[model samples]
Target: MSHTLDTYRLLGRSGLRVSPLALGAATFGTEWGWGAEQDEARKLFDLYVERGGNFIDTAGTYTNGTSERLLGRFARDRRESLVLATKYTTLRRPGDPNSGGPHRKSLFASVEASLRQLNTDYLDLLYLHVWDFTTPVEEILRGMDDLVRQGKVLYVAISNAPAWQVSRMQAIADLRGWSPLVALEIEYNLIERAGERDLIPMAREMGLGVIPYSPLAGGVLTGKYSRADLTATPTGTDDGTRKRFNLGVGAVTARALEIAEVVKEVATELGRTPAQVGLAWTLRNPGVTAPIIGARTPAQLEDNLGALEVDFTARQLARLDEAGAIRLGFPHDMLASDRMRAETRGDLKIEARQ
Candidate 1:
């Protein structure tokens, strides 16, 4: 079924309602070297909020903090009606060792900075931006719970962390009566389905809504890059900055190009743009609560918002899945094997419990 921007969904086990497509503020400022300036960013913001979009996502350190500053200004009037989500843990200063991490100090300091930058006394949602693998889970959970108790943060979430670690943290929160993580953000798209093996499933079982970032695979699924562009040198312009970033992160490889071909084919079949097709594919996942749309321009934002109207036929979805499938390694593959299934069921017509 097709949804609108106002078709709100419950975020994980929480009662908070959020739009299916979140408005990402990562591209809200030109400080990143490739993003919309203040006026353009405001236009993007207005376009989204006018369309009944209420989930606005950003980070305290995004675009060197310009993103949050701009959002704070634009959202000043309607902040109460919007679910403003920002993250912590990315370094706020270059040389400060305590400026980042999931520890208590970093958590409190980052929340304070974010509240100030966002021009708000309380944050609707706060996420641990990255997992440093050094801080104890207890420290992170306790700190987040403390913020919730203090009313500095309403909800806590995580991003870019291992699946096992997230699950463990959730279990700890339940045991300790802390504020549970309501969302999980990860780089997920047709070209990057590694999250499917564990992260997606983990979120489903642990009650964390999976919010995918880079749902377009850094524009690789937009059908803009050709095989010839793979070898072209990246320049310093805004467009070149994206290409350079994509190349540096290995986003525009031969395999990714193959996946883009399938996406374009599906988009053609559906009379939609490749960007819409790609974003729609992410929305189809039952485990996914929302996919962050990082469009830098009003036109791009409008195109991305069309993803809500896209519905894929079974055949089209299967083709897209085949083009970018990943190996679910180890126990997942082993358990799904026919022989293992037969051994477990003994040829009985077993109906799996939903």
Candidate 2:
């Protein structure tokens, strides 16, 4: 069945009802050499909320905090009605040792700053932005729990973390009676299916809702980029948005363009935009609670929202899946081998319930 913004889904094992698609505020500011300015950002926010979207995601360090500030102003009247989520742990100051990290001091400091920028007394959800290998998992969990106890945060989550560590941390939180991570955010898209190897499965097994970011593969899946765009060097006078994004972490590749071609073909067959087809593929996953949609303009946001209405036939889904499928690697492939499955199941005619 097709879904809509008002077709609220429970986030993970939690009772938090979030929209099927989340509005990402990373494009709320122009400080990144991209993104919408305040006026345009407000229009995007208004359009999403008008369509019944309530889950909005941002970070404390996004566009140097401009994203949060703009979101704060835009969401003030509807603050209580929105499921506002933001992350911490990214450095606010370049050289400060305690300004960032998943430790206690950094968590408190970042939350305080986020609260100020958001103009909210408490955050509906606070995510440990990224895993800093330095801190103990217990330290981060206990700190997040403390914030919940103090009423500064409602729920705790983790983003861009390894599956093994996150699994361990969730276990520790369960045993210690601390607030557990209710969500897992990661860069998930057709081009970047590496998270499917572990992170996606772990979130389902561990009761953390999978919130996917960059579901459009930095707009590559929108079919705007071509083979020439991949190899061309920038002249430095252009917009620099796509160039800088392509060079950033999890940059686009030749294989990604191949996947985009499939997305484009499917969109053509279905009479939908490539962005809608690409985003719809992510939504098809039962484990994915939401795919954060980032847009620099209201028109782009409208196009992305149409993804909720896009549906795929079995053949189309299979084609898209095969085109973007990643090798499970190591143990996963080994365990899924026909011989291993036969051995594990004693060659019985039993179907495994996934």
Candidate 3:
């Protein structure tokens, strides 16, 4: 099925423009076990490009580099046709000690390995993947700038880093004339509003493209396993199949069911599925540059890609907002207080209506 997405947007703070939805190759091969076969992986890549997807994300540690190698083989013929983004800083070996870190040596080595596996001379964008307090800001910045200079990476980005630290890196990079971050890969969704505290604002201010990894929140937001869902029982998390693995969220569990019920209603009204409703809700967020959809099969990818057709009216969005809404907390909560609003409006003679 063809998609309506045509023009691409510039990657966060960078000159690279990519499709609104990117294909995540974390499930490309079974380096970590439980992944698509190589032939199936190739088909998935072809289908994504067929649907106009132009951005791809992978990592060195994903399936112990199986994902990157598979993507490299699949894209070698069409490398210039897509915007490829991969990450470093995740450990694959247990006792290597220097296998993964934000340090210059690790970054350099990781890129070299990734390049060999990816069969590419340069990356469109490279992310640090996570923060490591062991490395100083200057060292990290200079190291990444060196990669850009060496033509190993076209742009530098950070993922899962604190707002202050991200800001400091930017400050250091700017002062020293090093490369700036162009994107932020974060765990963000409607049910998880924690990023709003600082990450969201910082990304908006710094012009970083926000690529939400799990827009479906490990199927939590998809409403697939709720009691009343009438869908397949959720895949077992016993063998560590669950992301956020085992946090034991009764509140989230209950809320997700409630949200599932609401989603069923909305989906019925719109003639769509509950999953479609959830994905569409995430798409309505203006701050998100794209949602990385992970699929183990062509059929699964089809289901997610179909979500682009699901649109929400103002009233529909308001309902889902109430269902999956998370408390902003702290200053955000204080600012939302009616008393504060009333006080601020008093100077304009906008007193309480009562």
* Highest lDDT scorer: 1
Candidate 1 Cα errors over 4 Å, as ranges? 235-241, 348-350
Clashing pairs in 1: none
In angstroms, the error of model 2 at 222 is 0.4
Report lDDT (Cα) of residue 242, candidate 2: 53
Q: Which 10-residue span in candidate 2 carries the lowest summed lDDT? A: 234-243
Give all candidates' CA lDDT scores.
0.92, 0.91, 0.79
lDDT of 1 by residue, 1-354 (tens): 438989898999899999999999998887767788899999999999999999999999999999999999999999899999999998899899899988999999999999989999999999999999999999999999999999999999999999999999999999999999999999999999999999999999999999999999988899989999778666556562366778766778899999999999999988999999999999877779999998978999999999998988888988998999999999999999999988897779967656
Tens digit per residue, CA lDDT, model 3, 101-147: 88888899999999999999999889999897778888888999999
* Per-model C-alpha RMSD: 1.3, 1.4, 4.7
Tell me which residue pairs clash in candidate 3. 12-209
- Model 2: CA > 4 A from native: 238-240, 247-250, 348-354
Q: What is the lDDT of residue 112 in candidate 2?
A: 96
Model 2, C-alpha of 32: deviation from truth (Å):
0.7
- TM-scores for all candidates: the values are 0.97, 0.97, 0.88
lDDT-best of 1 and 2: 1
Task: Write one digit per residue (lDDT tens) for candidate 2, span 210-281.
Answer: 999999988989988778776666546537265566645436578888999999999999999999999999
